[model samples]
Target: MTDSLKKINKQIRFLSVYAMVSSVLLLIALFLILKKDRITGNLTVEELTANRINIVEPNGLPRLVLSNVEKSPANLNHGKPFGIPGGNRGGLIFYDDEATECGGLVFSGRKDSSGKYFASGHFSFDQYNQNQVLYLQYLDDNGDRKTGLYVDDWHNSPPYPEFRRTYKETEKLPNGPERDAKLKQLLEPVNGDPAFAHRVFIGKDANKASLINLSDKKGKPRIQLIVDSTGEAKINFLDSAGKVVYSLPNKANH
Candidate 1:
């Protein structure tokens, strides 16, 4: 081949190589720009708005929900009904690792048909797949107000699955004796069994008295230390039937 032709071939090969390298570099630059757009380290906004917001784990498990009454999600595992519009309740609800509702803080207040004012704030934590085991509550109905902390017992008979089944069954029944009977039957084991009872109560009662009431597994208030709204203090020891077996200042002054 001619030397001039050979030189021309060499120049062509170099141009082709340069073109491939330039294309690859351009592709890499474009890719980097696109990737940068996707990666956000920070954001600034004047406000954020939503009816319901769920905060989830990396694996898409819901950890928490912030919702208004109309948008509150139902706790199907716990047999909780869905929120109704204009229910006048709203708060943050939390979920367990299994995405089951464990507890939440909720508040509601409104005037009733009798024009009586009512308000309540509740913070509760539930046992696994069960109803609330601990609750702190404030309630104002009409002019009467009470604030208290409660601890409840758990029973094995109406396990979560059974509870859910019974709840669904009851929902299908109308408001009548049949429904009442069914409900009583369902609650009998839990209510009648001494093993499952309200274990502790400490706070102001409906009578406007501050008291710490201690109960046995049988649900009998065995002891009560109370200070009435009038600042009278007393200590009482009670029998299983709750008759004051022994009391300071006796029954008359108490």
Candidate 2:
């Protein structure tokens, strides 16, 4: 071939290779951008499996966590841990905007040796920085079961960790009047009233009675609407001491 023709052919070949490289680079850049968009936007997958998954906000504050028993997280208050480490059971824990533990649903059911079995499920929500104020729980141990919806009261003066610390301190003391008095004082922080109480319970008890119990501030049952296992129904109203003062069908009627 002539020199001029050979030089023109060489130039064309170089340009062709450069164009191919540039096109490949452009395709790669587009793929990267699209991948980032999928990450920040919505990603669909057929299956997901993980020991723990934390859904967080832009600020890295966790809003929810789904975890197995071994990977569950400790309770949090204002982004800090308190009380005990979690990992007690598998469940989902929810948090507030401040990263405080707001609520959770945990469940466990297992059969041990000797044919003994136990199962429990608890769903609860706290009262802001305080302890659980409402819950639905089911407990079954060797055929003895209690399922209930509970409404509780918590102290507003101290945070839950502080209250727990005080209780633990009191528990370490020798069992006697002094320890009892300290425990009592810890629970009754404001005036002589009880700080925490189970205000309401509506469910079946271990005794095979379906009942709705409404208690006083001190957690003493004041009114009970019961349907016993025998299908007998009764409404009882008690005084502060919890002694039944009145009944729907009086003893004479019975």
Candidate 3:
């Protein structure tokens, strides 16, 4: 072959190789940038769904997989991957010392069908017992769905960790961000109703009071009853030591 012809062929070959390598490198760089954006929530759900690829982060941690992945806090069940799906791993579920950590709250209050979410057991108390903390939780995230009275308050001290927690008040209460308005609406008695005409009263044996059927509001009947030939009235109370204090009979319950 002629020298001029050979030189021309060599130049063409080198250019072809360079173009192929550059194309592959550019594609790789684009893929990496797109993946990084997804992990930081920059990619919308719609974008991710169409992408079909899992959004993996540093350490190759898969934070989410389009619409096919879910994750939970570690110690979720004391298992690996913490409690998340998608293979995303956080070192561990952090355990805070100064804050109290207990399970979710649950209660069988009368307002709701199943129950309210109050503090889990492992109660807390102030030195004076005056500022007691009944483990309370947010069942609805708003604290308006449940009540402590209906769900027998289980007062038992547990370890207090260092995060924020809610508590229920049995007798002594705290001045937190004021009782939730909805809570008051649910708890207040229906006033001016002929059905609940009876008023609450206190006496030495106020339990023995004679009833005239919601006559005056001193202490009235708790619930309406037809009283069959064989039925008994029951009462429940607590004592000084934070135990069932006393239980009296419903004398006027006839």
Candidate 4:
């Protein structure tokens, strides 16, 4: 080839290589800019405030909720318009991946019409569409107090939907004998023969006695071991009627 042709060809080859390199570099820079915009490394904030905050999963399912009194969200157990007077109580609520309320910590205190003070703090875990299966609670009513831990059993049939429906219906009824009777009938399955009942209670009772109570599935306390305020210890076995069947160390002895 002639020197001039060779030189021309060499120049074209160099320019071609340079163009390819420039295109790759530009593409890489564009990719980095897009990545930077899409990512967040860390953030710091001075203060954040809101009535309620929900932490959710990528699919928008709520996993946790931190809320003030007025904004507390109701759970599956309570459904909507929580029948209780303290639905506005402040608390941190937790939900399962399915967004079912599993448990939470709650607290409230108020005075009744009779000027009697009442307060309670509870941290509980539900039995999947059922009432609280386990809980730690502190309750004070007009200076009478009881702090305890409880584990309860629920009937398997009828399920949560029926329970929630009955609860809402009962709430609409007027406060009278009729309502009371309806409540009793509706609750008969749960309260009367409860498939399983209060299984365990470990706490201090209103009389300032420290006790551990174990009950039968029929809701009858079968055994109670107690230490009274004066430090007297007694263990009692009771029948279904709650009448003491027998006592250890005899009631007369400390």
User: Best TM-score goes to which candidate?
Assistant: 2
Please report, in order, the local distance difference test score of every candidate based on alpha carbons: 0.80, 0.92, 0.32, 0.82
lDDT of 3 by residue, 205-239 (tens): 22333222211231334422222223544454533
* Model 3 CA deviation exceeding 4 Å by range: 46-254
Ten-residue stretch with the least lDDT total in model 3? 158-167
TM-score of every candidate: 0.72, 0.88, 0.29, 0.72
The lowest-lDDT stretch of 10 consecutive residues in candidate 2 is 35-44
Residues 1-254, candidate 4: write the lDDT tens digits.
Answer: 69999999999999999999999999999999878765644547799989898888878778888988988776544334334443476988877766777889999998988899989999998787666789999999888999999989877666566676786889799899999877776666654775447899999999999999999887689999999999999899999999997999785665
Clashing pairs in 2: none
TM-score of candidate 3 relative to the true fold: 0.29
Model with the higher lDDT, candidate 1 or 4? 4
Q: Tens-digit lDDT track for model 2 on 26-131?
A: 9999999999997686877999989999999989999999999999999888999987787787999989989999999999999988889999999999998888
- For model 2, the superposed segments whose C-alpha errors exceed 4 Å read 1-28, 31-35
List of clashing residue pairs for candidate 1: none
